[model samples]
Target: MRSTFSSRLRRHALLGFLAIDMLGLVALVVDQVFSTDPVYPWIIAMGLVIAALPLLAQAVDYVLSTPADAAIVPDTGEKIP
Candidate 1:
């Protein structure tokens, strides 16, 4: 059971990474195509933020689901809310 849960978490993490990377790529393309000025920094920052959403979400989930006694553990063992 724990193995299955871990597997699911791994899969979700991979998907999240891909989703973030895609969003970053899209943002880069959009900025390059539409902006008149060199907006690479802004685009990169936006991309970073977009990419970070899933990670942030996961972190929040972990935090919320974690029991007080296991707060120090990297991953939450409880069911997500």
Candidate 2:
């Protein structure tokens, strides 16, 4: 199946968040090892918040796409007995 632009955007956003989180972690480690006054802990926290944006976007998308009265069905083809 071909992916839509929104899906691509979401994926890219998630990847960007991951990159930022990784950079923040590396900076935190470097700061702790070298500096007496640390500042990158806030960067880590900001990274966490940034990571959550993709999740929040996903949740909003799910809520918006699903119909209010939609039936719940398992992906497995097995019928309920």
Candidate 3:
């Protein structure tokens, strides 16, 4: 059970990393193509930051919601028998 949880966590982390990297690449391309003025770099930076916000929120929620032990907890606010 622990191994399965760890494997799932690793997969989630990898997916998050890929998502951030892809967002950065897309922002870079957009800045290079659309913005003609000197503000392009700042635009790219802002875009990346905005894209990362949701991932950051999810990570925080995961940390907060996970218990010290390995028991699965449902988010429905009801105790399971």
Name the candidate that leads on TM-score. 3
Task: Please provide, for model 3 over 1-81, each residue's C-alpha lDDT reduced to its tens digit, 9 standing for 90 to 100.
Answer: 998898678766765665666667766777677766656755676677677767765764576455866566655777888
* C-alpha TM-score for every candidate: 0.44, 0.42, 0.45
Superior candidate under TM-score, 2 versus 3: 3
Candidate 3, which ten residues in sequence have the lowest lDDT sum?
A: 57-66
Query: What ranking of all candidate models by lDDT puts the best one first?
Result: 3, 1, 2
lDDT of 1 by residue, 1-81 (tens): 998798679767865666666666766677767774656646665767676777766764675453777655555566654
Best by lDDT: 3
Better of 1 and 3 by TM-score: 3
lDDT of 3: 0.68
Superposed model 1: Cα runs more than 4 Å off = 36-81
**Mind giving the per-residue lDDT tens digits that candidate 2 earns over 21-45?**
6667766776777664566665665
Error of 3 at 57 (Å): 19
Query: Would you list the clashing residue pairs of candidate 1?
Result: none
Model 3 shows how many backbone clashes?
Answer: 0
Error of 2 at 6 (Å): 1.1
